[model samples]
Target: MSNSTSETVSFFILGAYLNIGYLRYLYFMITAMLYIVIVVANTSLIVVICVNRSLHEPMYLFLCSLFVNELYGSTGLFPFLLVQILSDIHTVSAPLCFLQIFCLYTYGGVEFSNLAVMSYDRYLAICCPLQYNTRMTSHKALIFIILVWLYCFVKFLIPLSLNIRLTLCGNTINGLYCSNYLVVKLACSDTQVNNIYGVFATALSILVTVLPILFSYMRILRVCFSGSKQTRQKAVSTCTPHLVSLLNFSFGCSFEILQSRFDMSGVPCVLRIILSLYFLIIQPLMNPVMYGLQMSKLRNICKHVLCYKLLAGGRNTVTESCEI
Candidate 1:
């Protein structure tokens, strides 16, 4: 393919999709259900947090932001996957592909940034209980949330811009989605600039997000060790969910990075597909369920809401029966 060919390339062929025949419909149904669950679960938690004045603390606000990101990321991927799964031709238009890349990439960036901020919030609430109120107010928490999102979206635009200018030698992507790394690999032109910038951006993102998490946890750990039993219990209650979420997301991302960057030909196609999607699929589903169950206040509120709705429906049914 000539340099001019890249400009003319309008769409990309996703080569990794296996011919599962009629089973594709089964996959579609399953994916559709999972998307529904993710949306409802995350949205419910967000609504609960927003509506309940008692839960309007900085930590809950951060949780709300995290849930919103889950919704954003799941929406980006699940719809595209549903369409591609049922279609015989697994191709995505160049423009749509790039857009998906932007959404997914920014989603991941915001997720890490949100988690880091949440860790810092936990640190403040635990280590500096008295100053926590003055230090991390709801207004400041909102500002942090806004900044995390804005920073990720703006920061990722650099790479997206770089990606769009590449002279592609190929149009086939090996995975279910358009990956920046995979797309860059198809470029016939020198990707030295892209590669260099990629390394820089990735390193910067990791450092910016990871360093705060480490520092926050270190201080939290210190407090837990020297403080009273009540202090340790408080730290454990709050930090456990965050720690689980962080580790789960990090594990999925690690596998995705490995699959994208290295040769995964030895892995089974079925297993590879599952692993590639693990982060996107699992994190959104897991976060709300884990948080809803683990956080006593949120859990109690959710139960109250559900019970009220159920009772109201039952009363409406009884009233209709009497009228009839």
Candidate 2:
């Protein structure tokens, strides 16, 4: 592969987009609606947590971080996707593609790190109820959130840098969006450094994020079993949403990884596309709904806020009607 050949490639052709004919508009509308829902749901929750003084705890702070990340991740993908879906050509400029890759990878890393920290917060609250305030202060939780974002942003840069420098023999990607793995596969140059570093980064990420989650949950479970019924009920009530969210995200990510790395030609194209996008789509949409409804404090506050707004609007309408 000539260096000139790689240098000549200025854009990438996404090969997975199907010829849905007129139904493209339908798909675009559905995708647009989904994006809107995700944005509204996550943003509403973030605002709920931020404005309510009573909700300013370690867990709520973590939830706020999670909601913000959902917005970040969805914004990275949805706008780009809407444009592509409407266009006749399914091509993306090199710079834009790389930017998307950076946004998405960092989003994933931060999400995992946030969830891990949230698990640890839960552990402190449940396992060491007396010392939770001393152990996990709001200031400390803020620091952890800042560190999680910074660490993920910095950690993913290595791969993104390596990826951008690659001499690609091809400019075709077999997916709906820019993927680091697919981009690396197109490289004509030796990718031993990239491959080795990828493995190392992935392992390190799992060790850091997964270990804390496992340890925290194990302690929580131990306490639940040995303690009174009230202890068990408390653990179930608080931990259920977090556990559900973690499992849902894990499954979605697993589907994405499997779709990306393995040959899935036997699978239907529509199903394959859905499975590939499951992590990005489902997690953003699900997190807010799960957390908002499951947590009693959040649910009550949301209801109160919503009812107040509705009543205020009704009062204004009645006043205007009387004046007319």
lDDT of each residue in 223-300, candidate 1, tens digit only: 999999999999999999999999999999999999999999999988899889999999999999999999999999
What candidate 2 gets wrong by more than 4 Å, as runs, is 1-5
lDDT of model 2 at residue 30?
99
Q: Worst 10-residue stretch by lDDT in candidate 2?
A: 1-10
Q: How do all models score by TM-score?
A: 0.97, 0.98
On residues 20-108, what C-alpha lDDT tens digit does candidate 2 reach at each position?
89998999999999999999999999999999999998899999999999999999999999999999999999999999999999999
> What is the Cα-based lDDT of residue 60 in candidate 2?
96
Q: Against the true structure, what is every candidate's RMSD?
A: 1.5, 1.6
